[model samples]
Target chain A: MTSLPTHTEKKLGLAIDLDTCVGCQACVTACKGWNDQGYGAPLSDQDPYGAAPSGAFLNRVHSYEITPDQGAAVIVNFPRSCLHCEDAPCVPVCPTGASYKRVEDGIVLVNEDACIGCGLCAWACPYGAREMDGDVGVMKKCTLCVDRIYNEHLPEEDRVPACVRTCPTGARHFGDFADPDSTVSQLAKQRGGYDLMPDLGTRPTNKYLPPRRKDAPDMSAPLAPLLDIQATGFAGWLDKVLGKI
Target chain B: MHPAPSVIVFTVLSGMGFGLLAFLGAGLPAPSGWAAFFHWGLGYSLAVGGLLASTFHLGNPQRFLRAFTQWRSSWLSREAIASVACLLALAPVALSNWLGFGWPRALGLIGAVLALATIFCTAMIYAQLKTIPRWNHWTTPALFVAFAGAGGAILAGQSGAGAVMSALLLALLLAAFRIGDGAFAARAQTLGTATGLGTIGPVQGTVRVFEQPHTSPNYLMREMIYLVARKHVQKLRSVTLIGAGIAPALLLPLTPPSLLGFAVIALVHLTGAFAARWLFFAQAEHVVGLYYGQR
Candidate 1:
């Protein structure tokens, strides 16, 4: 049962735009808020008010200062979650048949009932996608909001993943990637979207549109005139006197 | 990567237990009746006790039986099946030898192979994780089997084979250190690659973490990004080499042939092996740590 499906009916995944993301963490917040009430077990927090607090979260925003070839250090907010990879390494490593990629949609999920909480699936994942719920004693991962996507009761426009729907900057986009012409796929193609650790060969369904480089302002260019000013006034005479020293 | 004590007990205790089983199944110093009772009893106690210890870290220990369902695709599942089958195969031999009915040499031989295979499966669990570059190598499994073999031979009272295997273990330990020392660097996965900045920042200037996701450490950071004190680990490595490898190789041959003598050597070797395994988990650098700006 841990064996991965060779093909999914629909590759439903995310295309995160690094360019527009402002590191607001709204997606992270929205994800946590929605997930606490929906789906499997509640994302439990250990020692919430204590000094050393740690919790299980399906989505997280990590900030980085990357110095590009042509730009000043860019601060890119990377949202970490389950990628729902095509060759998902996390699935087959599960001793219990808890971790699996859906055949209908490419989303990877954990069946809490079956999970032994051994954490091997978490170990096998390269993206740090899965986290073990210490309270429930099961592995929890990004379900891509499987409960919400096809919910007939919800309004049509409010049906995407919580993170994608709540992103103020629209950094997260969700669509059926199995269709090449889908918005997520087109955005990926146009922006040169890439897989995280492609060399690891997970063939991740989610793609990241790289942070676009901005030309760095030359540090010396602005300072040259101030450092090499023409002394032409009484103040300049003071400069001449100081030069002798 | 946290080097959980439960896992340490499981790997060290069970590895030795199975290793001892392999030797016992092979008919080394064949003991029967009450003598066989003590020998196989120790083997089962360690093996079963260690297996029980493994459940301590699990979130859902009650659901452990489900682990047996996925052996076709899971190494962990395969390990569960193999270990149980091995104990069962050797069961007939143990019962027969104890009752003075028969030796069951053929069944014992089959059990011996299964015992080694169980150890192999256990090692493969760690070796398969590409995320931890330090453990993702052939050396991981090789080291596990080597330690098991050396310790098992000694426990079975085969001093000659134990001494030679101990020496080989020392060489393997050194080689493993040499290769594993640079394993993380060899992967060349910087924070740049981890965050998808490498494509734009091809020159690889500097990609430092400006801010972390949370002020407090998260589960991933705590579970996967353990940074053991390098000084303590270096000292422990010396202890492992001397106590487990060199001391066993040199002293096992000279010690008078007696149960107490072999037990002393085996205890020393197991202690050293415990240290080695502790270092193995503590020193490993998981690739996910890169995201948290950890080595």
Candidate 2:
């Protein structure tokens, strides 16, 4: 059962814009709030207010400062979750049939009932997408908000992953990547979206838009003198009078 | 990469157990009566005990039975299935040997094959992980086989010279694996490749870790970012080579063939195996750590 399906009907995935993400962690909190309450297991905290608190959460944002040669340093906010890879290594490595990919939508999920919590899947995942819920003793990861996305109770417009719905900067976009005309696909094409560690060959469904380059400050314009010698003494009085005029 | 003690014990002990079982099942010297009992006892105990210890690593040990159900793909599942099959096949051989009767040669052959297969499955569990570049290599399996063969030869050998030769060969092979593994450079990916920023320019000059995602250590950091000091690891590596390889190779030849001598050699080898396993896990650098700049 751990063997992936030959093909999924739709490649439902996300397109994350690195250029627009401000790293506010709103998506992280929003994902926690929804998934914790909505469906399946709650993201449990061991010592919520204690000295060393650790718990399981699906979505996490990592802030990185990247310095390129011949340019100023760039701060990149990398939000990571389950990539729902075309060939997910985590799926086949599970001893139990607990970890599997949905044939319909290409969403990788863990069947908590079947999971032995051996932590092999976590090791298999290159992105470190899976985390163990120590309280319940089961592997937990982002389900692409499966519960909310499919719920009829929620308004149509709001029927998306909580992280996507709550992104203030609209950096995260969710859609079927199989459709060439899909908004996600269009964004990916326009921004030249790329995969993280493409050499690993997981063929991650999610794409990251590279950070846009900021134009270097123009140095051709006339420069101002650092110290105004004329303004220091008698010329200072004359300059002050000229400035008033 | 945390070098979980349960896993370390499982790999080392189970490897020796199965390796000895393979040798015994192949009718090595065809021991009679009490000697046969000792062989069967040591082999079964090591194999079963190692399997039991492995369950301790699982968060939900009660679900251990489910692990055997997915042998079609998962190496862990194959390991579980193969372990059971190997034990079952060897049961008859052990029983026949203990009762002073010769078992069918074909039955012993099957058990021997299964035992080796089980060890191979165990090796594949780590060998297949592309995420950990250190573990994802042919040398991982080769090292596992070498360790098992050396340990088993000491326990199962009828002659001192044979045991000495096996241990020496193990030492040589261990050195080869270590040298080869160390010499191999990581060419596939780096911090820039991990972040998809290598396309932009040189990442080292442009990037730095401004802040970690969490205020404290998280599961990913704890599990993947295990950083052992180089000096400490070098000391431990010496301990491993000396205790597991050099000591046993020397002691097995010099000491007279006695239970006490075997016990001393086994102890040293086990310590060496433990150290080697610890380094194996600790040294493995998972690609995920690149995001945190741990690698």
Per residue, candidate 1 scores C-alpha lDDT tens digits across A1-245 of 89999999999999998888999999888888888889999988899899888888999898887765654666778898888999999999999898898999988998888988899998899888988886887888899999899999999998999999999999999999999999999999888888999889899999888876565567757767778778789989999999999
TM-score of each: 0.94, 0.93
The CA-based lDDT of model 1 is what?
0.88
**How much is the lDDT of residue A39 in candidate 1?**
92
Q: What is the lDDT of residue A48 in candidate 2?
A: 81
Q: List the residue pairs that clash in candidate 2.
A: A65-B207, A65-B208, A66-B206, A66-B207, A67-B205, A67-B206, A67-B207, A68-B206, A231-A236
Where does candidate 2 stray beyond 4 Å? A220-245, B159-185, B201-205
| Top of the candidates by DockQ | 2
Model 2: lDDT equals: 0.84
Clashing residue pairs, candidate 1? A137-B59
Supply candidate 1's per-residue lDDT for A209: 84
Candidate 2's residue-wise lDDT over B256-282, tens digit each? 878777777888888888888888888
